[model samples]
Target chain A: MTNAIEVTGLRKAYGSVQAVKGIDFYVERGKLFAFLGPNGAGKSTTIDILCTFLRPDAGTVRIGAYRLGEEDRQIRGMIGAVFQDGLLDPLLTVEENLRLRGGFYDLRGRALTQAVEDIMKQVGVSDLRRRPYGKLSGGQRRRCDIARALVHAPEILFLDEPTTGLDPQTRKSVWQTLHGIQREKGMTVFLTTHYMEEAAAADYVLVMDHGEIAAKGTPSQLKDAYARDKLILVCHDTARTAARLREKGLACTETADTLELPLASTLDALPIIQDLREEIRDFEVIRGTMDDAFLAIAGEAIRE
Target chain B: MMGFALRNLKVFFRDKAAVFFSLLSTFIIIGLYALFLGDVWTSNYEGVPGIRYLMDSWIIAGLLTATSVTATMGAFGIMVEDRGKKVVKDFVVSPLQRRSMVGGYVLSAVTVGVVMSVVTVVLGEVYIVINGGDWLGASELCQVLGLILLSTLTNSAMVFFVVTFFSSTNAFATASTIIGTVIGFLTGIYLPIGSLPETVQWVVKLFPPSHAAALFRQVMMAEPMAEAFATAPAQTADAFREMMGVQLVFGSTEMPAWGSLLVLLATALLFYGLSVVVLSRKAR
Candidate 1:
């Protein structure tokens, strides 16, 4: 299958300040792709250029077979975007906002109404359809924004910081809904996020810094290549657990809450968990994370 | 384009404060004319036949002309709000063409201007009749309606041009205030054009909506004007009409109705063309 998005030598600058330095990347079709970076790392500039909102100084961008400069209108019909800011009209109801967005794609009358209904249901905002957008909670508003973008059923959906400012529960719920929609529709989900855990869900990740690609790989590949693993034991008394583990000739670091034991290999995980099962309230083999991998590769945290 | 235009209209009407504020200038002008300006203008024409009707029609004509400008400015407020709120980016990235987006805004402003102007005309006629003035005949009413359309086109295009320079609601609101206050002076609503200095009278003549106001006054005040000046000399009535700007005079030549119509049409075309260029450039 053709890639959902393709770019070569993509470059954009605001006057003397270069927002997106020359870069190259492609997102595979029907995959969850995350562009990970901190603020001012050109994540938005790259997305804006890809979504046809900003004109690049130099590049060839092809979104689902439509060239960026020449076939923008066609490309627009094939892609949807949920920006960092709320695009829904606060004065309008959820249904009205969806209907308005649908109209932009030329859906009208019964067809437009049905699309709004289906999308509202899909995003679990069906009950909020009659409520004014301003009256919705933060989580509800983000869901409505996603629903608005989905009204046209674009082949690829770009979400820029989709879960920013959301509570942990709401963020998890939003991700679950996104995954369901992506799986059901086989839509290419391209997103940029500040949270490394969010990027962990991507089939592929591109870590960017200073307008350049710092690293690109699957989450596991990134972790394996750059990060280290450890064993975490949570208990009521971490000092007691650490002493007991130390007596068994297994060394561990004791923090106020947990004992962190280094793991040389996965083969050692089960033996340790079985040995410490009685003393520890919780025992788990901790794999290296995308956050660890990102720090390892960039030599700095994703967020300052 | 119609979809976007309808969305703009919906957004405008949904915000009751914005709707009231858009017509706020028109209401103020009407209030002043009824309470204070009416008495002063009537006193000037004391002992003259049909003074009440003539002065009432004069003020109503100016109000109708002012309606197009103020309402259109209010309509453009939606565009500014969309941009300020960043909702415009959604449309920018949509399948909608840039021209269609601009067309939506321009069309909605014209629609709002025309609609509000019609309401003003209805209310104005009612007020005039209550004050011993006459209702416009059907033919004259049709002529007045046609003038409103042209005036709205000119107003919408011109306001859209100014609005393109702003991307913040605060800035747009400030512009609306400035335009609302200045429109009366430019259209000779606050005082008769002849009463201003000669240079200012020329400025009024050159103002775009002033021609539309002159056109509306010609149709609205025609009967009352004839009755008020029936015993006066032909030159006296013509001079009074020109002085008050019910008729525009260029040096020695008194401009015919078509001359004012041509000026309005030219204003509409010029500003519309300019705004399209500005919007196209901004779209990129």
Candidate 2:
């Protein structure tokens, strides 16, 4: 199957600072690809180049078979973008805003009207069609923006932090809408999000840092790669167990009431488990998460 | 492109402040002209000396051109606001051709300019008639109206070119006003370009407004087009015809209306074409 997006040796600079450092990646058709990064990780710059909002200083970007520089007009037709800032006309009603966007794609007459109505329905904003965009709730405006992006039936949608400032319920609604689009139309989605939960929803994730790809894999694969297989032991006699573990030269993290050990193997856990039975009241072992993978790679906490 | 243009027009009309300011500026200039020159307009053309007749026409022409500059702010602001809001981006990525966008914007500017000019001119004429003056004849009125249209078109092209390069509304507004005011004062919109130094006259001659005002002054003061062309130099009938051709090229209405129209068209096309190229390059 053809890739939805392919970037080779992409680089960009702003004056003296390099924003993107020769990064390369391809998004598979119909799959949701999430670009997970910290605040200054170059996600936005990359998205801008792909969306045709900013020119790359070097390299090639191809959306389907269309090259970025050679067939930009054709590439633009197949891609939809939800910019970081909502680009709606505050003076226009929600329906009017959608109608104007449809006009950009040359949709007119009855077809334009139907297209607006259909997208509004899909995004669940049909009732707010007559209200001015400025008066709508933040979530409603976001929904309207999404509906506008989809009005032209673009095959690849680029969403830049789509749920950045939304409340939990609103963010969930946005995620649900995105999921619906992906499932129903099989539209390839490329999104950038700082939210780990949102990143977890992607079929593939690219973790970026310092203008380079730090890691790339499915969410589960990342979790598996970084799994420490650790066990947490909560006990009344933590001092004795901690001393015993320290004497054994095992790596252990101790709290006021518990001692945690990084168990390298199941056998190592069994021996420790057998020795600490009387003092241990509770014990639990769990697999690592994408958050752990991120922390491990970047050596910095993800700014939630 | 039509959709964007029509939408821009709709927004401009919906903006009460923009409409009010455009109309207010036009009327204020016309009112000032009437208060200062009512008697001169009513005086018999036969008794007035030739030079004074020429000067009176020059002043009126400058005022008309100044009015065009004042009224175009609203249209220029609309374009600037659209760019800030990324509305231009939506169009840039679309299949719409660049020429259509330019045509649509120019058309909208012309429509607004024409409407404002008519209202201003009609009110100015009524003020003159009410103050014990006779109404202008049909041919004279046509000539004045043609001057107004041509001057406004030239002003629009100049403003459009400026706004295309300078995206900031404040910058465009400040620069256009400063430039327009300087041109108006130097060309003697309230005085007479002929009364200025030879160096000043040479400078004004290079600008479209100088010729535009000359044409307007000729019609307002009821001077013959031939008499206005005679202000420059003595020459062969063919050389005189070529000078008339230059006036026709820069003049609006009279014998050489098409020339001014072409100048305005060329300026509008060049600036608009540059705007398109800049916008396309900026779009990644």
Candidate 3:
């Protein structure tokens, strides 16, 4: 399948200050692509350029098949976006809001009704269709926003900080709903979020820093490159165990009751554990988390 | 565009406070006239013929013209609120054209202006009859309705232009309140045109809504005006007409009805053009 979005050398500047300085990325069709960054990391600027809300200083951005600048109106019809703030009318019922959004895509008569009904059911908000949007809880409002965005059934969905202010349970459910929609519709979901775990779930993650891509890979690839796997042992002798491991050519950190082995991968911890099995009381291997990878990578970018 | 317009219409009518506040000035005008202005004017013009009918017709005309101004400004609260809540971004990202969005706002504001002003006309006519004045003839009523459409267009265009400068709801609320207060003075509703200083009277006369008021008076007050002046001297009727803003008099000549219509038509076109220019510039 072709790329759902293609942004090449996208450079956008506000007067003298460059917000997105010559960045490039693409999202494959039917894949979840995530951009992870801090507040001023140019994630939003780049997304705005692709969404045709902000014109880039120089770049060729194609949304699905439509060009960003030349075919902006067409691109708009082919994509849906949910920004951080609530944009749906508070006084309007869930169904009314969906009907209004579907109207923008020229859905009317029976087609409009069908689209509204389909979107509500697809986003699992069918039960709340008649409820006023303002009366909904935070999670429910977020679901309505997603439902409104999908009313037109666009091939690509752009979400800016999809779960920024929700509680953990609500965020988890929101992500679950998103995954369901993406799976059922084979939709390309491109989102920018501050949550590392959210980005880890994406098929591809692009870490941005200071208007540039600091790292881009699968979660495990990033963890392998920027973070380490741990091999820990519960033992009685702290001093002798450390010497025995060092003499046998295993590098480890010694503590009062345990020795730690930092290795390239969890697979690398096997041989060390096999060699130290007799002296060790118990051992366990810990895989690095996305947060660990982020600290090791984005932490350096922030410090510099 | 029609969907957006319908949504705006729905939202405006749903907010009961907004609808009432839009007509708050109209109620104030009626209250002032009822409390003391009505008796004071009737007593002051005791010797004149048909004085009650003339003053009633004058206040009714001023109320009709001012409704378009206040109601449309209140209607524009939706536009400013949309901007403040960032709801406009959703429309910007949709397939809806920029012109369509703008047209939706203009259409809805004009609709609200026309709807509210017509209601004012009906209520004003009923008030006149209850005060012992004859109901306007069908032809005159039709003419008044046509005038309502035109004046609403002009008033809404001007209000929409002013609203483009505001985005916050607080700022919009303050602006609508200021506009509501200033509308009476602008249309010579709170006081007659001749009551102001000479230069200030010119400013009121130049005001587009005042011309609308004059046009309304030309139609609604035509019979009563003739009755009031039939027993008086020739210049007396002209003085009363000029004082009460029934006719916009220039330095030496009275402005004909067509002249007021021309002012209103020109004002509508000019404001519409100005609003489009400002909006297009902002888009760029």
What is residue A263's positional error in candidate 2, in angstroms?
A: 6.2
What would the per-residue lDDT of candidate 3 be over residues B1-284, giving only the tens digit for each residue?
99999989988998889999999889899999999998888897898877888899989999998889999988889999999987898998899999989899889999999999889888888988888898899999999999999999999988888998898999889888888888899889899898899998989988999999999999999988888888788788888888889878899888999988999999899999998899888884
Residue clash pairs of candidate 2: B57-B217
- lDDT of each residue in A62-179, candidate 3, tens digit only: 8888888899999999899999987998888898889988999999999999988888887789999889898999899999999988899999999999898999999999999899
Off by over 4 Å in 3: A231-261, A267-284, A300-304
lDDT of 1 by residue, B113-135 (tens): 99999999999899889988888
Model 2 per-residue lDDT tens digits across residues A1-304:
9999999999999998988999999999999999987888888889878877678999999999899978877888888888777877776789988998788777889999999998999999999999988789989989998998999889999898998889999999888988997899999999998787787878999988888998999988877776466788998688887887789888788877877887654456777788878878998875566777777767675553
User: For this target, which candidate reaches the highest DockQ against the unseen true structure?
Assistant: 1
Once fitted onto the true fold, the runs of candidate 2 whose alpha carbons sit more than 4 angstroms away are: A227-241, A248-250, A254-287, A301-304, B18-64, B85-87, B122-148, B176-187, B190-202, B220-284
Interface RMSD of each: 0.9, 2.5, 0.9
Every candidate's CA RMSD: 3.2, 6.1, 2.7
In order, what DockQ does each candidate have? Answer: 0.76, 0.33, 0.71
- Per-residue error for A40 in candidate 1, Å, reads 0.7
Q: Quick one: best TM-score, which candidate?
A: 3
Q: Candidate 1 residues A1-304, lDDT tens each?
A: 8998998999999989888889999999999999987778889999998888899999899999889999989999989999998888888899988998899898989999889999999999999999999889999999999998899999999999999999999999999999999999999999899789988889999988888888999998888887778888888777777788888998888877888887766668788888777877886677788888888877765454
Positional deviation of residue B239's Cα in model 2 after best superposition, in angstroms: 24
Tell me the deviation in Å of residue A113 in model 2. Answer: 1.5
Per-residue CA lDDT of model 2 for B1-21, tens digit only, reads 667667667777777877776
Better of 2 and 3 by TM-score: 3
